[model samples]
Structures are given as C-alpha cells and as structure tokens.
Target: MSTPQMIRTPLTELTGVAHPIIQTGMGWVSGASLVSATAEAGALGFLASATMTIDELERAIVAVKERTDKPFGVNMRADAGDAEARARLLTKYGVPVAGFALAPKQALVEQLKSDGIVVIPSIGAVRHAEKLQAWGVDAVLIQGGEGGGHTGAVPTSMLIPSVVSAVDIPVIAAGGFYDGRGLAAALAYGAVGIGMGTRFLLTSDSRVPEEIKRRYLAADLNGTVVTTKADGMPHRLLRTDFVEGLERTTGIGRLVDSAKRGLEYRRVSGMSWIEYLRDGIAMKKATGRSLAQMAQAANTPMLLKAGLVDGDTSAGMLASGQVVGLIDDLPSCEELVDRVVREAAERIRAAGATLVG
Candidate 1:
C-alpha cells in the first residue's frame, strides 16, 4: 500500500519565485538550458557554478535570465578563494535563492540573509541540520546514502526524522527521490518536499550524452560504488574501468602521477600557482594532512570538469547520487516535472479515497 497525502508542504510557498519544487544543482548538467526549462516548468532551478569559470557562469546566468523571469538559485563552492566574488554576483544578478552543496559558515549565511536572499544548504546528517538552523538557514536539503555524488551513511528514512526532531526549519529530502512516490515518502518522514539530481540528469533537458544517460538507466540498485581514490573525498561513481584502475594503484609512480595531474589541473582551472597551493594548504589544515601531500590533491574544479565538461570518466571523479540506478528514460524538463506532479496528485487522491470509509 503506497500511502500518500494531499498535504501542501511549506516549500510550495513562493520564497523568491513561483515553484514548490527545486531542481538539485547537478555540476555540468545544470547549465542554462536545463535551469531555464525547470524554471519555466514552475519549479526552481539551480545553476551549477562550481563547474564553470566566472565568465562561463556569468553567461549561463544571463542565459537563464533571458529564458525565464522566474526565480532560480546558483550552487557555489564555499571553500573556493573566489567564493565571495561569486556570492557578490548573486546580488548583482538578483538570484532568488543561494543553495550550497556543502554547509557554509554562519557568517556567509548571515550576510546573504541580510541581503534578502534565502539560504538553503544540502546536508546529510541531523547534526549538520542543527548547526545550519543555529546559523539561521532557511531550510535543509537532506540526502540519504542512496544518493549519488558525495553522500553520508544515513538514509533519508533515518536522517529526515532526526533532523525534524532536532530542528524547526523546513527539510528538503533528496537521495533516492525520483517520482511522486518518493515525494510522498519524504512528506511521511516530515520533509517539506523533494530535491532531485540524478532524476533530472536523465531528462531531455540534461546536456549529458545520450549514451551516458542510457548507461545510468540500465543500472540497477547497488550499481554505484564509493571510492575515495578520486580527488580526496569519497565520491560515488559508476563502476567503470577507470575507477578500477585508480583503485589498483599502490606504487611510487602513482604518487608522482597524482602530483603531476594536480599541477596540470591548477593550470587548466585558471588558478594561480599560489592560490592553488593555498587551497591545498587550507584543505590539509582542515583534514589534518601535511601541506605538501594536499598540494598533490586534484582541485574540485579540475576533477569535476574532467568528467562534467570533458565527459572523460577516466580522468577524474564525477559526483552522482544513487538515484541514477532507477532512471529509465530521458524526458523534456517540462514533461518530467509534469509527470512528477501528476503522479503525486494521483497518489494523494487514492490515499484520500481509502481514508474515506
């Protein structure tokens, strides 16, 4: 029995635009075309700026603006040296909401709030939600372990209830969400709504190659694997030969290759040698690693670009949530949103009828 509800969650309220739904920002996949389509479909879209250069980001933002007057958000890297500059661009472009993939400092949240922007950060743990609530975040987007990209061990089944009990803010449940059934499940767990990444990635509006989209659809549950060998974090990726090769390396030459790759990555990212080194230094300080060791770590932009823009899965890590396993077909952004809502409505009605003894 798939029980659903007719409850209109708080996320439906117009925060800065006219949609209750939010499209999770998918790195290279969330370009202008996808963002605009989502916005036009009566949902909020997010432009992924982490994968783009400043100039590319500006152009994409402008393109989205031209395509729709509805509000949209931009995902940014909190640890980047130019993060402040990117934040300022939000004010310049008058973006409706600012969504962070990682938890941001309270100061940045306060600043954005003061500027009248709604601040929502994606979190995987209840403790993180409590911290964000204390930091004055507007809402929390919770992802379960089933999600692709970077995810925590806790599933939405456990995390949503935990966060709801620990905090009083809106919770957006992510991870395995795809259809209305997922939305209904999220509501049952006390989340305000759902945010999707992989589901959207399989849509017609998605810019990834058809073959790649097909690869995701053919995947069944448990197809994704978590590997820390990519970049420095535990990244969920398709079990491909490239990932297998990296996992098998255990020699001096491997370390040297990693260092050389990081250097080349620095050049391609338009970051000066000093700034690149600085980021590495800061990362090492935070992670308790030696500065020199982190200097050999591949930067986020480079790794994401290698897979996102260049589509070379062999080169670096691509962040994906576990929902990729369930996708079966690519529909237009409008069609996808409509199908979700329509299915949700039907589910609501059926459940309501059952209660009408």
Candidate 2:
C-alpha cells in the first residue's frame, strides 16, 4: 500500500516525525506501551515522567526504544528533585525530545540544551510560549481548556491563535481534538499540528482500565467539571461521586489528610518534607494559589497514579477532558492516527474550494 502524503510541518521535519501530532503526557497512563505506539505510528509520543522515578524513567526509555526504532519524548516535572537524572537519560539514550509537564526553570532548560535535547514544554497561555521560546525551547504544545487532565482556562480555538501569533517557534495546538476536523482546524489556525490527551487516553494503546474507560465514555458533554478542590489550580476531571465528596469535605479532616499525603509524596520521591512544603509555597507565590490549595497540589499526582495505574478508583482521582463525552470506541493507535490524518487532509482540501471562490 502506498503511504498517504501529509502536509509535513516544520516540526515534522525537525523532529523526524511524519505528522505534527503529539500525545499529551498523562501521569502513569502515558507509559511505554502508549508512547512507543504513537512514536511507531510516526507522531511524537511523550513518556509521562511526572509520577515515575528517574530509574523508572530510564527503564521506560529503554523499553520504548526496544519496541520501536522511532523517536519519542519523555515528559518530566520541571521542578522535580531528580529532573537532572532524566536529562541525563535523554542525552545518553538520544531521546528525540524533552517535554516539560510544568513551569521549567532556566537551569533545567540549559541542562537539556547543552546536551542537544529538543525542549518543548506544554503551555496553556501565550506568555508561557514566549517565555519558553526565550529560554531556547524548540517548540510549544498549547493545551486549551477543552483538554483533559490538569488544563488551562482558555479554549483551543483562542489559545491556538494566541500562542501561535506570539511565538516564532512551532506551536502544537491541544485540547478537545479527537478527530480530523479538529486537526484540520488547528492547521488553519497556523499550528503545525494538534496535540491530544483524552483522544489518546481513549485509544487502544493506552493502558487505562476497562471500567474507568467505560465511565469516561458514559460521560456527557457537561460531565466534566473544573475543581481546584483536588489540586491548586483548576483541574478538569470526570464528575464522579468520589470527586464530589472531596469537594464537599470541610473541617480538619481534609486539612489533616492533605498534610499527611504531602509528606508521603516527599518521602517516596526522596525530597525533604520541608523542601516539599517550600516547593508548594513557591508555586503558590508564583500562581497566587492559596496556601491550602498548594498543599493539596503536592499530593494530586500521586492520587492520580493510584487511579490510573493501580485501578484504585476509590482512592484515586480521574483527570479527564470534557471531550470524553464525544468518545465512544477505543481504536488502535495506528487506526486512530491514520483516520485523523486522512480526514484532516480531505477537510483541508474541501475548505480550500470555499476560499478560492
């Protein structure tokens, strides 16, 4: 069979990928299996390192490399204690990209740049794109509010043009992009391609449990809600009874539990408890999030890992996009990517006719 031609963007050429599409780094869910599959299908895939230890990240990189000879990225917490170790693996393993899951410091950017790793931090606003670009990032992935997991407030339609207009580097649009029409729209807005989290989460390559996946499919357009009750900033999640319970909780119990979890995260991750609190304070200072909310933020990802990886639905929280309502079937990574690219190409051509007249 002849390979269908795609309108390769500068990013595609720069990263040695066919399309400019990327799979968003979902904590625990975006592991070796999903990341390798996407990379093998010719789109950049990011290994979610937010929950994984540095050694675990090393194993994941090797595991993906063993599965496919294609290039893939590893996503890391920008302020993580062992971020430098992940950077070392990127240089040692020749990882194609280093994706930042949070606001990165200048030192982290320099550490990766000196090793020749292409740094691309996912951003939700225009200023962030400019900030990363100024720090010598190669590209930016902008996730609009329609995106799943923890997301920004702006919608994809506005964020795409906003970030693209602000930065000279390649901009990848994300959020609520489940099909070719969405991908086509992103290109029209001047994005190199689209990035997807929920779309990828619903794919067969993703290792999310059947029951959880089904719950996501059962959600309605209004099923997802933004709540800072789980983490510091607004987080998009499936509106589950468990989630509602947390949001409704008051008094000393909530505060005590949050403090305990924060300590546990610090210990397990090899960070001093005081340092963990300091990080929370710093994040609060930077984002203007309240002290209580920042304390809650320290433990959110660990809770997410329990649900996503361990399938402990009762204990873990589900971070999802509002688009889960639109998803019904789980297609293989290859099938999903091909369908999206094909449909987008057709749509783009059809739209051209209207403009020419």
Candidate 3:
C-alpha cells in the first residue's frame, strides 16, 4: 500500500516524526528491529531499556542507529540505581528522546533536557502528570487501567481528559487503543497522540515469538484480567492457566517462587549481588513495597522472558491489554502505522463534515 498522508500533532512536531503514533516500549518485545521499523515508518518508537543491562542497552541503541537514521527514544526505569548513567548514555548517543516508566527526579529530567533530549514519562494519574510537567518534561504518556502490566484503576476515557485538563504539556493517551478510531478518540479527548503497547507487540516487526503472537490473536475482549498476583502491583495480563495458578497460590508459595526467579534473573542479567541489592533498595524506596513485594518484583523480568521471549506460556505469564480481543492480524510496522493514521485522518474529516453551516 502507498504511504498514508502524515497526521501532524504536537507529538509529531515535538519528536520530529512524520506521524503522531507511538509504539510503546514493551519488555522482551520492543527491540532494535521493531523500533527501527517504527522509526522508518515515520512514527516514534521507544526501545525497551528496562530489561537490558547498561551494555546491552547501548548495543541495542547502536543497532537501531545502524538500521535507521530516524529519531527514536529509549525507555528506562527512572527508579533504577543506574538511572543517571542511563540518561548519560542517551545523551552520549544523541538520542532525540528519553522516556521513563516512572517519573525521574527533577535533576535527571533537567540533565536530559540540557542535552536537548525530549523527556516523556508514563504516568497513570493526573497528579503524576502535573508533577512531571512541573519538572519540565516535554510530554506525558498516560496509560489507564485497560493497559497491560502494572496498570492503574481508571479507564482511558476518564483518565485522558482528566490529565489533559490538569497539565499544559502534551499528553499521549494509551490503554485499550488498537485502531485508528481510538487515535481519533484520543485526539478528541485533547491528547496530541496515542501510545500503543500490546498493539505493537502483536506486529510482524515485533520480536515476540510467533506462537505467543498467535495466543494473543486468539484472545477476545474478555481475554485479559487485572490481578495483583503477578507482582505486588495490579498487572493486566492474559487470562491463562498459569496466571490463574498464580492467583490461587498461597502467598508463601508465591514468595518462594519469586526468590528462585530472582536468583535466575540475577544470573542472566549478570548483575552482582551488590548491584542487585542496590536496585532493590531503590525500587523499595520509590514504590514503598514490603520485603515480600520486593521479592515478587524479581518475578516480572523472568516471567515476561519466559512467555515473550521463550514462548513458554505454560510456565510464564503474558502481559496484554484488553484490546487484544480487538486485534486479529499481524501487520508490519509500516502497514500498521499507515493504516492507523489513514483511518484516523478519515475519521477526523468525517466528523468535521458533520458540522452544520
């Protein structure tokens, strides 16, 4: 198909991309191939750095640079012990944007901005949006309850307008968004763009295993469930036998499993015990999780790796948005971006035509 006409918005302008679509960073999913393809397709893509070690992240960034010259961002954990180091790496590479899953400290934000990087943080609430804006972030991406993994309780319809009204900075609406209609709706809600995670994770360019992608396609609207069993926080995931078992498992049993996974993750990540402890302490201080919850935190990476990377749904959990039910095909990044932008533009025009003279 021919390329669709560009849909310009503050998001496109701020990030220097041709379209207002953003392929969000998903652990074990968004990598060099996906990010570079999204960039070449004229939408901003964020590399998921939260799952990568510092060296791995640098290599991934270099890989994307080698593949495409289009501007893209790197998403990292703001609460990570090496957050400052990560920020400096972005600066060193001249990455145009820096995204944080958690709000970074004001100093960190300033440092990135000083280096001419646009800082965008993902926030779930209006208060968090306000706080990030106060720290001079370029934009905020708000994911509502319907989003996959570690989501809040509010739906996108309610959350987007609330945060848009609360903050002057650009807002990108996420959660439950899959098609162009969702993009049109978000723009109508006063957002500058839409951010998609599960949608992108299902794309052909995504590095997720093919079988796992099939499992996502098989799901219907009711295929997702929000549960606190995955970690200490509420996570939206596909309803599977393994996840159900997690819900049924006793707290002590869960803790023991978490410990085993944590040790495995430590070995795979090549982080020393001291480094792991430092990261754990930073997470505890940032999130105020109890020791048990801290242990559970380790379950996230390893479990996500099992399903998303290893395609072992029997032993791993899959994080997915409610929109999985709405998706059926695995289009490439170019086709997906073009279709969504085209549909959104058509919808907007159709809405305008309804206005009476």
Order of the predicted models by TM-score, top scorer first: 3, 2, 1
> How far is 46's C-alpha from truth in model 2 (Å)?
0.3
Off by over 4 Å in 2: 1-5, 267-290, 355-357
Q: Which stretches of candidate 1 lie over 4 Å from their true place?
A: 1-7, 14-19, 251-254, 282-303, 314-318, 352-357
Q: Candidates sorted by lDDT, descending order?
A: 3, 2, 1
User: Could you tell which candidate, 1 or 2, scores higher by TM-score?
Assistant: 2
Candidate 2, run of 10 with poorest lDDT: 1-10
**Candidate 1 lDDT by residue in tens digits, 282-336:** 5554346554446445644566666666777777555667777767788887787
Candidate with best TM-score: 3
Candidate 2, 281-313: lDDT as tens digits: 656655676767767777787778677777777
| C-alpha root-mean-square deviation, each candidate | 3.8, 2.3, 1.3
* Structural similarity to truth (TM-score) of each candidate: 0.90, 0.93, 0.98
Report how far residue 298 has shifted in candidate 1, in Å.
2.4
Report the error of model 1 at residue 270, Å: 1.3
Instruction: Score residue 63 of candidate 3 by CA lDDT.
Output: 97
Whole-structure CA lDDT of model 3: 0.92
Worst 10 residues of 1 by lDDT: 1-10
Report lDDT per candidate.
0.75, 0.82, 0.92
